[model samples]
Target: NSSVSCHIVQVFSNSDEALINKKLPKELLLRIFSFLDVVTLCRCAQVSKAWNVLALDGSNWQKIDLFNFQTDIEGRVVENISKRCGGFLRQLSLRGCLSVADASMKTFAQNCRNIEHLNLNGCTKITDSTCISLSKFCSKLRQLDLTSCVSITNHALKALSEGCRMLENLNLSWCDQITSDGIEALSRGCTSLRALFLRGCTQLDDAALKHLQKHCPELMTINMQSCTMLYPSCSKSQMTALWFVCLAAATSQITHTHTESFIHIACVFLRILEAARCSHVTDAGFTVLARNCHDLEKMDLEECILVTDNTLVQLSIHCPRLQALSLSHCELITDDGIRHLSSSVCGQERLQVVELDNCPLITDITLEHLKSCQHLERIELYDCQQVTRAGIKRIRGLIFNFIGCCVILGVNCVLFC
Candidate 1:
C-alpha cells in the first residue's frame, strides 16, 4: 500500500513540474498583453523582468489610445511611450492632451515613422515644427486631426503636401492662419484625400474651392462652417467663358456635349457639405454646388441670408439623396419653399431631419406642406412667431397621429409629434 501511494505522489509531482516549465510563444504573450490597458500593462511590467520586457514590447503598443489620460498625458509620458514603441506604432490619439507640446510630437515623429492615424485635436502648444517633423518622418500617415491647433501655419500644410502624399482624411478646423495658398498646395499634392474639415478657417476663399474642384476629384465631405470669405460669385467674364465653352461643345457635335457633361459630373463627388454661417454664399454659389454635387446626402446652409426659395428648389431637384437639411435662420424661406421641398420626390422619400430655427417668415402653412414628408422624423420650428397653437395642434394630429403638448413663445403648442 505504501509503494502504491509513493508511485501516485511521484506521478503528480512530475505533472506539476512539466506544467511549471511550459513556455508560451512570444507572439501569444504579446497578443495577451495587447488586451490590457496602459495602466494595467504598466502594473504588469512590475511582475517580473520578463513581464516588464513583454509589457513594453513595440508589437503590443501598435495603437496607443491615451484619450482617457488627457490631463495626465505630459511630454515625459509621451516621450517614454515613443521610445518604447519604436517604429511599430501605427495609431496614437492624444486628443485634448493640453500638456503635450512640440517636444512630445518630435519624440513621436523621430520614433514612430510608420504611424498612420494620429489625433492631436485641442493640443494648443503644437506648432509648425511638429508638422514638419511628422511630414518628414511619417510618410505612411493617412488620417491627421489638427483641430483647434491655432499656431500651425501654411508652412505645415506645405510640408504635409510635399511629404505625406498618402494622406486621406485631414481636419484643419479652427486653424485660422491657413489661406488659399496652403489649400492649393494640399489639393495639388494630396490627390488621394477623401474628407477635409476647414471649419472657421476664415482666410479661405472661392479660389481655394476652385483649386479643390480642379484637383480633388474624389473629395466626399467638406466642412467650411463660418468660412465667411468663400462666396459663390463668378465674374461676368468667367460666366461668359463658361457659357461659350458649353455652347461650343453643344454645337460641335452631340457626342461633344455628352463628353463635356460627363467630365463635369465626374469631377464632383461631394456627399456632405456644411457651410453654416457662410453669409456670403448666395444663390449663385449655392447653384454651383447644387449643379456639381448632385449626390449630396447632408447639407447645412444655416444663417445663409442670401439663400432664398430658389436655392431650395434647386436642392430639391438635384440633391435626391439629401436626408438631413438645416436651413435655420434662413428668413427668406417661406411656405413656397417648404411646399416645393415637400412636393419633391426626394423630400417625400428621404427627408428626415429639418431645422428651421428663427425662420421668421415660416407660417402654419409650412407644417401643412411638411405632412407630405412621410419619412420626416424631427423638425425644429423654434421662434417661428407666425405659427399659432391651433396650427401646431392640427399638424401634430395630422402627422404623428398623437397629440403633442409643448410650450413655444409663451403659448401651448405642439413642437414635434
Candidate 2:
C-alpha cells in the first residue's frame, strides 16, 4: 500500500512537471481540448488545474450538443455553460433536455448573444419569456427547433419576429397555442425565412398562409401537417383539413382552387413538403402544388385519403425534380399511378423513395412499373396486401435492401422487417 501511494505521488509529480514545463504550448493544448466532447472535456477538467482552464475555455465551447445528457441536464448546467461560453457559443442543442427552464435560458440568451443556432426542441418547461430574452439579446439567431415546446405561444413568435430578423429555419411542430396572429407577425418581420415547420398548429387558417406567401419569397420548405383548419372553405362556416394549402378533393382533372390565400403560397419554390394526414386533400390541391412548386423534390401525402392517380399524374408531369413521394394509406392510388410516376422523366431519373403502405389495391403490376425507376432506392410497401413476396423479389437490388439499408417490405409484416 505504501509503495503504491509513493508511485502515485511520483506519477502526479511527473504529470505536473510535464504540464508546467513547456512540453506543449497552451494554445495547442486548448486546440486539442476543442476536439474533445463534453463528457471527455469534463473528465479532462478534473485532470489538473491547467487542464480545467483549457477544457472550460470559451473558445472551446462554440458548439455543444447535450442530447446524450438530456435527462441529466438541468438549468444550472445551462447557466454555467452560458457563463463559460459567453458570446463564443455559436450553436447549442438543448433538444429533449426536459429540466432546462426559462431562468437559465434567460441567462443563456444574455450571455451567449452571438448564438446563431439553438435547439430547444422538447424543452416544454420554458414559456414565451425565454424567447423574449432571445429576441432582446440573441438577434443573430438563424435556426431554432422548438418541436413539442407546447408552452410557446404567439408572444414568443412576436418577440422573435421583431428581434431575430435573420432567422432562416424554424420548427414549431406541435406548438398548438400558435395562431394566425403569430404566423402573420413572423411572416411580416422574418421575410428571410426559408423553412417553417408548424405541424399540428390546428387553429391557423388560409389568412395565416397569405401573410407567408406575401412576404417570405425565399421560403423553400414548409410542413403544416395536421392543421385541420388550414384551408377554410368560404361557403362553409366550419374549418377544413387542407392546411399548408396541402390538398383538396380529388377531381378527374387538375383544377385550381378559388381560395386566394392557398393560391398565393404556390409562389414559394419549395423543395421539401410534408402535408401528411390531411385526408381531404384531392387532385385540385396536388395540381396547384405541382404546377407551382416545380422544384419540389420530396413530398409526404401519407393518409391523404382523398388523393388519387390524378395527383400522381400532375406530380409526374409538373414536378420534374420529384424524388421522394409518399402515398401511404391513399387507397385510391392504383397501379396506373405508379406506372405514370415510374415511366416519366422524373420517375426514371429523380424518383428515389416511394411509400405505398396500406394501399390494398396495388398488385404485382405496381412493382413491375417501379422497375424502370433506375434511381429508386426505397419503396415502403408495408401492409400493401396485394403485393406478394414474389413481386418484391422480382425487383433488382431490393433484395439488397432486405439485407441492409432503408425500410424492409411485406404486407401484414413488421415495419422494420
Candidate number with greatest lDDT: 2
lDDT of each: 0.75, 0.78
TM-score of 2: 0.82
Model 1 over residues 1-417: C-alpha lDDT tens digits? 999988766644553232212466657877899999878898877765667778888888888889999989899888988888988899999999999999788888999999999999999999998999998889999999999999989999999998899999999989999999999999899978777888778888767766766677666556665665654333221111111011111111222223223325333555665556555456766676677677777777777777899988988898888888889889899999999888887788888878887889999998889888778876777788897768877877766522332324333433545
Count clashing residue pairs in model 2: 2
Winner by TM-score: 2
CA lDDT for candidate 2: 0.78
What's the TM-score of every candidate structure?
0.77, 0.82
Q: Write the per-residue lDDT of candidate 2 for residues 44-126, one digit (tens) a residue.
A: 88877678778899998899999998999999999999999998999999999999999999999999999999999999997
RMSD of 1: 9.0
Q: What is the lDDT of residue 401 in candidate 1?
A: 26
